[model samples]
Target: MKQSLTLSWLLAVAFFAHSQSFNNLPVNTQKPPLHGRHWMAITGKPLAATAGAMIFTKGGNAVDASCAMLAATCTMWDVLSWGGETQALIYNPKTKKVIAINALGVAPTGATPEFFKGKGMKYPPEYGPLAAVTPGTPGGLMVMLAEFGTMSLKEVLAPAMQMAEGYPIEAQTANSIERGKEQIKQWKYSTKVFLPHLGEKREAPNAGEIFVQKDLLETLKKLVEAEQEALKKGKNRKEAIYAAYDRFYKGDIAKEFARGCQEQGGLITEQDLANWKVKIEEPLMTTYKGIEVYKLQQWTQGPAMLQTLNILENFDLKSMGYNSTRYIHTLYQAMNLAFADRDFYYGDPAFPPDEPIKGLLSKEYAKERAKLINPDRNDPNAKPGDPYPFEGKTNPYLTLLEKWGTAHLHKPTSQNPLDENFLEEFAAGTTSVEAADKEGWVVSITPSGGWVPACIAGNTGIGMSQRMQSFVLDEKENPFNVVAPGKRPRVTLTPSMALKDGKPFLSFAKQAGDEQDQLLIQFFLNMVEFNMTVQEACEAPSFKTYQMYSSFGKHEKAVGSLTLNSEMPAWIRKELSRMGYKITYQDRTSGPINAIYFDWENGSFWGGSSNHGEDYGIGW
Candidate 1:
């Protein structure tokens, strides 16, 4: 009888152990997932996430925490700088609405197609002052903090300000500086800040070495002083923050910024600074299987995801099997179709030649586009379709579209070879920030442009944006996106949010240039369709297609090429190759995707930071 009791006990113990296992999903992940009850902060760097946690601990909302994270990452030079542009999507709990922040900078004065053509360029230069747009991130940060945050600008910027004074540099940024020393030496102010030991064997700061930027510290202080003075003059919180914004765009700071830009051979004027404003606009949304997905409007490549989702909705993706050859082919073809439309039809809404966003997002248009998918093999010659007809307008650029389709032939523009890593320079990756609170505030941001090898704009200690290269030189390539002074470029910086049952469902963003929407689409589906946990979904093997034109340098494309996770089965690779795919393998195809999933059943937050990069997350 004692032996029988022991057997029963062992069975019970085994059952309990199985039930207690937290990760019940089939997939294994390199990193453990994060769970939080009150708040969650995730960003590209560890210090940046810590900065967000500091704001959350101070009783600030998600917007405040996100702004703090953004500032800190920019200060750390995590693929960006203070002068980079910011694109964000914020979920305001009070209004129960999602809002898009269009903080992308516009082409400065004298920036035009003719101007670029005169410089003997196919498109804008990839780097240097001539490639810069007017600074937008400073204005973006102040506006987001003032409009939605409960904390003051001074409070939100505390962590970044401290870092600007001096902080131990991480290996990533330090090594990037070392590798780009030659480029850094070309710019006097950049050399002054990035190379502390200019004449040493390693000109850049060593890992863990203290790196300081006195000019940036002083510039931040000047903005704070303006805000404080405004408060003393009886200004409201929002007004006081705007006071700082005014100082940056129209006051002494603007004078220095414009002068420094021109001194570096850029075209920005003080009037350009004053004229540039932060636009808080309505976001575009499309419902995917009862969940409402939101993305910034036409100026960004975000709508392409919506279009891809729309096309994909017609197929039964779940039955095709996860990571199966058929599934990969479907997604690749759908993305190519959507991105082809994006390459031609997307641009700034505030400019002329209005984008047919209405027709592009129409269900009928999606259905028509979906029918074009060749089930047997890849369609390297897939071209943009007529979206205008769905919106009741005749297609005005049909002729250009036809000629462009035949002329491109899925190849890079005929340009001189690059000295840098062509793929990395083509992607021009950035960093992302994700934050959320139990109070219902959610923020998703993808800010980019001024990376290492960036040119610094004089004593302002700000790196100039390299975003002007995103503009097309010829109207036939993308008529709506042709470079013009005061027009925003068609950028790849896309931040995404989702809502279900009238509440926040997921807040996610990533850092790859033209591949942003592609990676995001897979990440979102990994959870919603495959039933994987957030972290599993984040680290899951994903494939990349280069059938669409790149949004960065040379606007290149390689027809029939696909990058799959290196661990993909040999049989799967053979099958894909048989279908006419030029397969390349990478150990990690999931680029730093940071996300927050709302655990409505538990009334908490689940955060996911991919294991591949230095992306980190904290929950409390």
Candidate 2:
């Protein structure tokens, strides 16, 4: 309690130093902002957002509506599938506290560093059954709906079940299927479902064509049947939901999943499913100018945002001028420093060799890290700092850190963000979900894995998670993140929320791999520092740094790499390039940020869906 008070005092001082406000400007956004008096639902796909809207219309709270959106997006394969993982932050109006949902899957049996090394691989494969972790979305959805939501499973899943029966395939998904047909063909069940037009020139479903997943529909029906049976036995709503959850993880669904996984050279077993459980935990938080910002623990990269905020607290970011050379460099340097620590220290807390989360979030520690920044140029060699000392301990991995530094210094630098491979690996898979209702319930979620070209788990119509690729085999890379059975990888998925004056203030998330935190940090600053509305912040031109190791595909990093929006002024780009930075340009560097701002004064909600992708929102 003393430590908390001290930290709060330090943050308060920092906030006061930079409390001057910027002028609110009239801005034109590509997409109009959404205003609502009752509810708001936004996500990666139009149809999925509609699904949430449907639930809200039926009088469901934000949790139930969010569950519906998650289901519909997974069902539509909006860069995710049923066999993927879920990570969420929910604000409960009754408790006035934020709760974190850790539904991320874990490495299955026989999935060890030595096992993958024996396969002549440095890291786990990016695709196929061998890359699978046990599925978590089904269990996660069930737990959330049962505990916080008022609706039954049948009602929440109705839209997704209808989608499973048949829905018009969108161009994005259809094209993705066509592009990945070769990999899809490698898995028999995947080929059967994704390549319905097999032997034809296209081989995949066409946009606007009715795509059907009979097996998936049947799978949904089975879950409903389990819930119905449990209710008939006099079970409560929550108990009935758990019955369905049991059927998915321990009964016929589990059997088929294990059988199909084994058939495809995967490591998942029925035991893995039964042993897996979704954890509802107290989230980590930090105060940025009196706004309480929350993020999941270190098992994810979420805390890096908290760390970044801590470092930025030292600078007068608002006075630095938004998107100015000074602002960009400061934010980039802070992000790199935070991410450097994230790469080395973060992992599943359930594993051994605990992370120094205490020292990492220390305001004093952030000040120490802030001293390492160079005011003139990008630090191509920013290395992880020692947080153990701040926590009253010594770093046991000093030798490893030295060796890691040497290896990183020798890595080749890439100036090209246009490299198709880099972009593909960087953006990767995932989708965001944001919802809020008049009842004061707000939810932010970033769910991913089991995307297109997924390996189907037999006749269950469930795709196996490819999250194992996030694990590193070499301890020199990240000692805490080395692959081991039953351990969760340090994932890139992060959801964000902020509360001001003990009330819901903001709920936001995006669909990008390692860039999620970096982009989100800018989004928050745009609103608070520059006085931009939520919609303007969503569509704002942002910059990205690739200085940290990616969580996917060979785990590579790029030193001094910066991707700026094409709309950025020529003068700013020129100044940035002169500062020892590798500058690249893209028209849409914002990614697909979706956010909901609570208009407490107006007693309403404001929704922002980025124009960068197919993300959409509905409000009423």
Best by TM-score: 2
Q: 438-523, model 2: which lDDT tens digit per residue?
A: 99899999999899989999999988888999998888888898999999999999999999999988999999899999999999
What's the CA error at residue 315 for candidate 1, in Å?
0.2
- TM-scores of the models, in the order given: 0.95, 0.96
User: What lDDT would each prediction earn against the true structure?
Assistant: 0.89, 0.90
What is the RMSD of candidate 2? 6.6
RMSD of 1: 6.0
Per-residue error for 254 in candidate 1, Å, reads 0.8
RMSD of each: 6.0, 6.6
User: How close to the true structure is residue 302 of candidate 1, measured as C-alpha lDDT?
Assistant: 97
